[model samples]
Target chain A: MTVSLDLSDVTAHYGNTKVLEDLSLHVAEGELVSLLGASGCGKTTTLRLVAGFLEPTSGRIKLGETDLTRLPAHSRDIGLVFQTYALFPHLSVRDNVAFGLKQRGEGRAARQRKADEMIERVGLAGFADRFQANLSGGQRQRVALARALVIEPRLLMFDEPLSNLDAKLRVDMRVEIRRLQQINGTTALYVTHDQEEAFSISDRVAIMNAGRIMQLDTPEVLYSRPANLFVADFVGFENVIPMRAVAEAGDAVRAEIEGGGMIDLPKQHYTVPAQEFVLASRPEGLLVDTADRTDGLPAKLGLRTYLGRAYQYQCDTTAGPVKANGPLGTPREEGEIVTLIPQPEQCCLLPREAK
Target chain B: MQRRAHPALIAFAVLTFLFLIGPLVIIVGAALSDTSYLTFPPQGLTLHWFQNVFEISAFKRTMITSFQLAVGGTALSMAIGIPAAYAMARYRIELPRFLGNVFVLPILVPEIVLGFSLMKSVAVGSGVPIMGALLLGHALLVLPYCVRVVGASLNSFDFSIEEAAVSLGCPRWKAFFTVVLPNVKPGIIAGFILAFITSLNDVSISIFLTGPGVSTLPIQLLAHMEQFFDPTIASVSVLLMFVTVAVMAIVERTLGLTFLTK
Candidate 1:
């Protein structure tokens, strides 16, 4: 059965330093939500709060209709897969997977059967009799997942589960984890500092900075339309140029850029009194043309790198150094002058305070 | 095809090994002598002094006392040390550095000073019985070993396993018993053996605490040696050594001695 998790206006502190401030999130039933942020940005703390390892200073945590804010970790009926795997070193893989079931006083035969099935599901069938010390990093990670899932918990949580893995195994394990979660229809909260890993497996990613969620949306939406300058820059929007709004239309506003140029931006996409604002766009959103063009900004190319699939060019423009990607077939020289044009729909307008 | 070790290094290593264990060999040789006086390279080999050890009534009583003290002290120390070490290792106890130094202060103090301090505080000042004083002293003496060994074990332990158990529907205490205890068992066993040995072989502390009708084996042996110089003491020492070795072998068979070295 699937269960939803909700945390509303939660605030947590360690002594006098506030680690999480008024943080809130909701994970729909059977959906995987990842809290992605840099280290010490309170992503792990939020996961721990949901897993009952921490008690929020002021907030309400609910699973379906039941309140779990004050419940102890054991009574919460949640499963957590730690980054270190944290397998019981003294027990074999089978017993480690059966630990949660055994704690619930299940019969030995029942535990063995459930543990065996889960172990096979996690692709650790032959590792049942071996201790954790004998297994490789990937095998140990699978054991941790099986141990957490075998109990049929209401909610599942992971704290950087694949961080210890090698690059190749990390990709494989990410797919396996997502597949298992979907098949089981379990509500899960994953925490990781790696943005690519988070975007790969999570149904939706929440970008966090300074203990607050900057944006919560699908990975595609987050990449295309970021809410603020922080989310824009974090999600690879490298070109952020300051703009001044000259006039407002029905839904769009004409903004004056540096070097005597103008661009029309949708008013609904940014905050209102736009005295000082910034136009943000990803490198892929900008098109570079070596031939002279009247409708685009003039710039000199600095460095051009071949990224296997596309050519990345760095241009020295009035807005500073703007990076753009183009097709590999057309090679542009370093000192050549080029016209850089921004695709209107792919760019975002944000208030100056967001900086 | 392998390269040979230098002759001077080999000779130095042999000399170091002999320097460490040469006295034990002499004691065992003297224990097997049939002569009345203690002598190495005996004229005749016999087990006569071992039997003579059993004939003395005081030796038998003191041997029982020493066994009780070692066992009781080790058990008490473990009971007190596990929780102390766990708190120091896991919780953010206030004044942690100061508390750690206090817990291990017994090992740093000279044995003679510790014995005198215990005699003044627990035996004379508190007016406790001689046996109680000895038991308390031994417990204090061995407590540092338990804390240090168990603390080291807890340091390498991954605390998330305990958290996982708790999340899997086990209470905090049950999680500790099921997960933490089993993981740190090797250290527990090693600490118990070390504490037992330390309590068993204590002479300086036992000498000041021993009174009439209550004395440890080492104190009794020392008293016997003051007047008589014979091979009986050597035989007793060899027996004690055998008991220690037998205990160590049992430990090595069950939970390897690598934990003890750690």
Candidate 2:
């Protein structure tokens, strides 16, 4: 059965200091969600609260119709895999897998059968008898996974499970973990700091900052239509220009270019913010010119970097020195006058107050 | 033109070794003295003291008492220590720094002082018997070691395994037993054994708490030495040395002595 987790206004604290503040989330059944953030954003804290390791200071954690907030970790039927892959060093892979079953009073034969199946499922078919201490980092992680899945938990939480592996191994393990979750149809809440990992595997990525979720959306929406300036900036919106309304219509605005040029703003636009706004455009959306043209703004080219598949150029613009990418073999020279044009469809405007 | 080892470092090492083992070496040499005296560099070689030590009924009885105390103390300390260590390591308990200080204070205080205080508090006021008193004292003394060793192991241990167990449908206690406890076993065993040894060789506390009939081996040895300068004492010391060597071997095999040294 696919389990769904509902966290409503979950508040957690360490004595007087609050770690999580009025956190609310709804993870649909069979959905793979990631809590993405830097350190101290309460990402790990959220996972711990759901796993019953830390009781919420206030709020309800429910799995389907079952209230799990009051229950201890063991009674919650939630599985957790930590980043360090805390395998019992003394136990063999098979025994490690069998541990939970034995504790629940499953028969010896039944436990062994279940453990063997889990071991095979995690690709440790031949390493059943080997102690965890002797296994490689990837092998130990798989053993930990087998041990967790053996109990058939209703909900699974991964505490940055792939963060311990090397870069190449992390990518490989992320695929394996996602594949396993998909095959099992498990409800998963994965916490991680790597934005790319969150974008790759999560059905919904919750971007957290300062104990609150800044934005929660699918990878596409988070990248394309961020809720605020922070989310836009964090998602790599490169050039943010200040735009003042040229007319009293409010929507009709003009961005004064650094050199000598002005870009017109369309009034009564549905997407543009009405308040005093700053315009943001991604580097891929901005076009650079090498020679001076009548319609293009003048740019003092500083450096041009050949990036194999594309050209990365740094130019002095009205918004200060800005960086932008062009085609692979663009004939752009250093110390050349250039004009920059922004694709209106790709530009995002944020409230002027957004820092 | 050749570089020399640091004379001060070498001299300090030699002095430390001698300070620690000088008495044991003396007792070993005295065991072989043909003349009935606790003197090193014996005039003649003999095993008469070994024969005498074996024949002493008090020695046999006291050895049993000390053995029981050490074993019982280790069990009691481990029961409370392992979980306490885990709690300290895994959770952010209120005033953890204060609790940590309290746990280690027992080790810092003089053994004689702790022994007497415990006897007054638990034995005299609480009406605990001599055996109970000895067991209580020894357990308290060893509690700090158990916490330090087991707690240190848990601090360095990867907690992901416990999380894995929890995620697998195992309850918190079961997960701890299956995942956390098993991983910290080596540290627990090392701590337990060290606590046992400490209780075994304890003389300062045992001296004050020992009743008329119940006495630990170390107290018995001290009593025996006061009355006689016999070879039997030397033989008993040799046996004690052997036990210490065995303990060192076990510590080396289980949790490396390097950590203990630190």
Which regions of candidate 2 fall more than 4 Å away from where they truly are? A103-105, A248-261, A265-270, A290-299, A327-330, A333-337, A344-346, B1-23, B92-94, B116-127, B253-256
Q: Compute each candidate's TM-score over C-alphas.
A: 0.93, 0.88
What local lDDT score does residue A82 receive in model 1, on the 0 to 100 scale?
93
lDDT of each: 0.88, 0.81
User: If chain B of candidate 2 is superposed on the true chain B, what is its TM-score?
Assistant: 0.92
Candidate 1 lDDT over residue span A1-355, tens digit each: 7889999999998778799999889999999999999998999999888878888999999998889999888998898999999999999999999999998899999999999999999998787999988999999999999999999999999999999999999999999999988888999999999989999999999999989999999998897888888899998888877778788766867667765666555555554446778778888777787646643556788888988988889888776788887777788888888877767667777777742
Clashing residue pairs for model 2: A74-B171, A79-B167, A80-B167, A86-B160, A86-B161, A258-A318
Model 1 chain A poorest ten-residue lDDT run:
A264-273
Clashing residue pairs for model 1 = none
Model 1 TM-score, 2 decimals: 0.93
How many steric overlaps are in each model, in order?
A: 0, 6
